[model samples]
Target chain A: MARVVGSRLGVGLALSVVAVVIVALLSSSTRLAVALGLGVAVLGVGATLVSLPAVRRDHPVVTRALISVVVVDLAVVLTFRVSATSNSNVAIGAAMAIVLLGLSFLTGSSGQISLGNGAFMGVGAFTVGIWADHHATTPLVVVLVLATVAGALVGLVLGLPATRLRGPYLAGMTLAFAVAFGAILNVFSSWTGGDSGLQLPSAVVAPHWLASYFGPGASTLTTSSAWLADISIVVTGVALFLMANLFASRTGRAMRLVRDNDVAAELVGVSLPRARVVAFTVSAAYAALGGALWTLVNNAVSPSTYGFVLSITILSLVVIGGIGTIPGAIIGGIIYAFSAGAISWLTAHLGLNPQGNVASQLDGIIFGGLLVLTIVFAPMGIAGLVRHGWRRWRRG
Target chain B: MDSFLTSRNVSDLLGGVTSGVIYALVALSLVLIWRSTRMLNFAQGAMAVFATYIGFAILAPSTNYWVSMAVAILAGLVLGGVTERVLVRPLYGKPEINPIVAMVGLLLVLESIAAAIWSTSSRALATPFSIVDWQLNHKPVALSPFALYEIITSLVVMAIVAGLFQYTKLGLQLRAAALAPEVSRLLGVRVGRMLTVGWMLSTAVGAVTAVLVASNFFTGLTPSGMDGVFAFGFIAAAIGGLDSPVGAMVSGLALGVVFQFVGDYVNSNAIILVALAMLIVSLMVRPNGIFTRSAQRRV
Candidate 1:
């Protein structure tokens, strides 16, 4: 147990450092055509070096931790490079990755299902949008903090009733929340800008200070995007680290016990309602942070953006990544980003019209098929597959 | 007070009853599935819409509504059986959430396929009955010829379903299997096959509800045509008791009447909110539903 905890801490620190470095490298270079090639080589070497000690120690936990950190590092760099070169909306991908990570923590700790985190995310985005509209001078950090608080408040209200409901009843209630949230947004169109959404003001940045650290050629928009990505990575790393510690603590064990058997948990003196409420509130706060980051990155907020589809997509990410595991959520996010790109690429390459039925339905086909296949075949998800393969490789 | 009970209000009440019959049909289908499988079919609405689309295809070529309806019901049975055998059987007795998640995936896939094949555009389905309203004392009443057909057809189907459950041998087997699969299997009943039949019959009921609603009330048949109906049906089932068919029927009609009055007097956007509010209150007051026996415990 000590060794496991030590390895987790080491992995968390390594991930944070790598995230900061990637942000600096990506934000500094305008000639990403050259940076892309260099970044890949640097990442490959770094991965090799990180794995060498684990290989020598032959400690399973250490080896697993090292492998996960390396994979996350590789994904970040590759995704950044792809977005830089192709001009795709990598910010959305990054935001989604962060949200998925947060969701994994929430669902992992407590065995309850929430189909309304998207609504919480909307609350976060709208908080930022509305705040930015009125208070242009406030720093972005403050805005995010306020948004998170608002999200947590709403989550508390939702979570209160959630404690009493179980299974489909809980799911149905949350679904209603998502639907009603959309309607509320429509009804209060004047404040929320109705269906048209709200536009974010131009991001305030100190170019001279950034240039001194990141070299001289970085544009403001690129810098802003990179900065948001960096914050997302750092926040995700911190959240994962905290979650890892929490899972190893007494509270985490009790929550898991509650999830596995509520009656048993209650018999053991654990407060089921309190534990559930805390899990939900924290999860909602995490989703809100992701939403605030999304608003910063996208510079726009619309009610339509946080609908049922988004909620389902987030749920799919958690399930496909591997429920109750951080590594699984990261893997799920990576797959989600790549699969989305692949669908678009296939449509474009096949010369399918974007507005046509086939093109429009491709995403649902691929993701839905993948979801079903994952659950039916890999009940434990990508992380489970990896673990099984690792065991086999070791035996051989 | 006089204005509150005007002709418009009376018409709205009548319209609510007509629509309530459709809601009750959907609620009955949901209740049937839940009672047998202990799984809430999230894909119920999507499956119904798919069947309706299939019915539409047959109708387009033959212009025979009866044949289309019959074929659709048959297709629903096949779809339900295959889904149970292939997708649901593997996850039986696992965590309850597993099936729910799988059902959501199925919903997405089915809806996407329908959209791909039929496009997202809404098309008018042909109905045998006239849409024109009847006259009462020279003032046009809410009940049209199609509305009457809808009410009568739904009543007949409900009666048949109630009879099947109350008086038939197969129904007894189905109940035994649902209540205790292991015990039923020991008693020489094919529990697995009974569960599949339950799915088929329930899905066929859903198909009937979809066909009836689409032909007269909804008019515009699209991939997501039954989403609203599904939500209403879920609320109705919850109000009645997830385990009680009689409760589903009564709650569905009550919900329809309440929604109609709310829509007429209050804001239309508040309908879902009201339903959700009612659900919360009901669950708080009686977690097992108003109709359920107090001795029963829900997890």
Candidate 2:
């Protein structure tokens, strides 16, 4: 126990030192917000390291949350100091990670297939879009909350009947919803903003106090977008932390038991329907939260963006990034973010037309191949593969 | 007023029949796979779209519709065989959901390949037969030539499939292999080859649907042309009992007419939601399927 605590304390101190190096590299002219962020992260790390021996064994989840908070705090400040484009890129990645987390929980733990999560996300996005159309003055937090509630309601309604379904039947319903999303959007064009999509009346503006802090006398970070990135990171961080705890909770265990063997789960008195419904509803809420955050980064929502292809892509990425794991979701999101850039770059160099179908579909091909390979070779995904390799190497 | 009602009602009915055959054709393909593997081929739509792309390529150079269709079916046979052998073969005896997910991956890969070769732009395929609606007393009341072509083709294919399953030795072996692989193997049924042939025949059926639908029912030969059709067919397959091909045909046609009425009377956009509702309600009410008599669960 002493040795293990010593190692964790050493790792925590090393991370804090790296955090200081990153803080120093950003220069003194950077935001006081950055310094304040650094101070908080370091203090958190210090506090957690001190509490490691006490809480490490008995309250591992608390230990994990503390570590995650420190990581997120440092990341928020680092992303804030980056260029506007990279900041926006990070923001998009963060939002997608939240969505992937939802998928990982539903698919990885509960073992339900959902092809309509894109549409569910659309439910959240359009909540923001349609709500803003009618009530432009609604506070962002209230709108986000409403978006989540809207998604959960939709999930509950859909999930209740779906709980009785298995495999193809469940997938069939979700696939139908996904394929029909565009048609549904077109029906209420006035509210959904129709084909053209809805633009926020204003960009997601950081508040004045935040602007003053983030502006930092024009040290290269655009005030609002960077602040938006910061907000996105925080939201993503909270999602990560919450999902992690859920995975370690009794409900998560029940869902997993239901996934592995329904008969066994039933024998244990776990209500199969309730477990399935809870997984479905919770997954939908996470997707909605991710979608609501997307509005912050993109400032617009379109029907075309939330179609069957997007849904498939989301699933494929989850599988490729390692389904059913929190780290897998984040890894998948990062892979998606980077691969988009890489594909565009490769297509440009290869003389492929950007608007051409082949160039557009390159990512699909890569992800699809990876998905098939992952399922066959490493059912747990890239994270599983890495984890396996790490364990083998450690033994060697 | 009487003429107006008859004209609209008859036209909608004819239209429903036309689309219903298309759905039945797709449902037939799905039922074929499900009977053998107990797996839903989510890539069935994408595979159909691919065969259509190949058919379009053939028809583009020469305006011979039959020749293009023959070649397309041949293409589907080869593609399906390859898919079953390479991609799907590894997934057997695994979790039930793996096949579905892998097929989704195949769907993406196949659609992407189709797009890479033919592009995603929509284009109309030329129908050898005319599309002018047959009329009675100066009011359109029946099927057009192309619509008739679609129904006749589907009927012929359905009949041929039924005959093959009932009368042929190969079909008997295929059935035995799917029904009892261990016993069939002991009896020298060549279970592996049967599965490959099963997929080949199934995709050929889907190919026929794709080629025929390109005449009147399908929008155009786009990469996503058959995805919507796939969903409706999935509903039909579920209603028909995934194990029954005959059930697929009847339920598919019935669903087509009912789905048409919903689109015609209600908002057309509501069609998908209606499809989803039908699927969910049916799955909940009769998980074994409406057309099925037995409610046996396979472990």
Best by DockQ: 2
Which DockQ values do the candidates obtain, in the order shown? Answer: 0.52, 0.72
In model 1, pairs of residues that clash are none
Clashes of 2: 0
Cα lDDT of model 2 by residue, B40-154, tens digit: 9999988877887887774566658778888889989998999999989999998877887899998999888888878788778878998887766776756788888888999
User: TM-score for all predictions?
Assistant: 0.88, 0.93
Candidate 2: RMSD to truth? 3.3
- Positional deviation of residue B96's Cα in model 1 after best superposition, in angstroms: 1.1
User: lDDT by residue for model 1 over B1-299, one digit each (tens)?
Assistant: 43444388787887888989888988898888888888888788889889888877745665688888888898888888999999999988888778878887887788888998889888787788898888766678877999989889989989989999789999899889988988999999899999999889988888988888777865478777786688788878887888889989988888888889888898877787788889878876776678877554546
TM-score of chain A considered alone, across all candidate predictions: 0.81, 0.87
What is candidate 1's DockQ?
0.52
Candidate 1 segments exceeding 4 Å error: A1-88, A203-216, A220-224, A348-351, B1-6, B58-62, B137-139, B295-299
Residues A28-98, model 1: lDDT tens digits? 45456336534554554454455555443555444444444444454445444444422234546555666
Candidate 2 chain A weakest ten by summed lDDT = A213-222
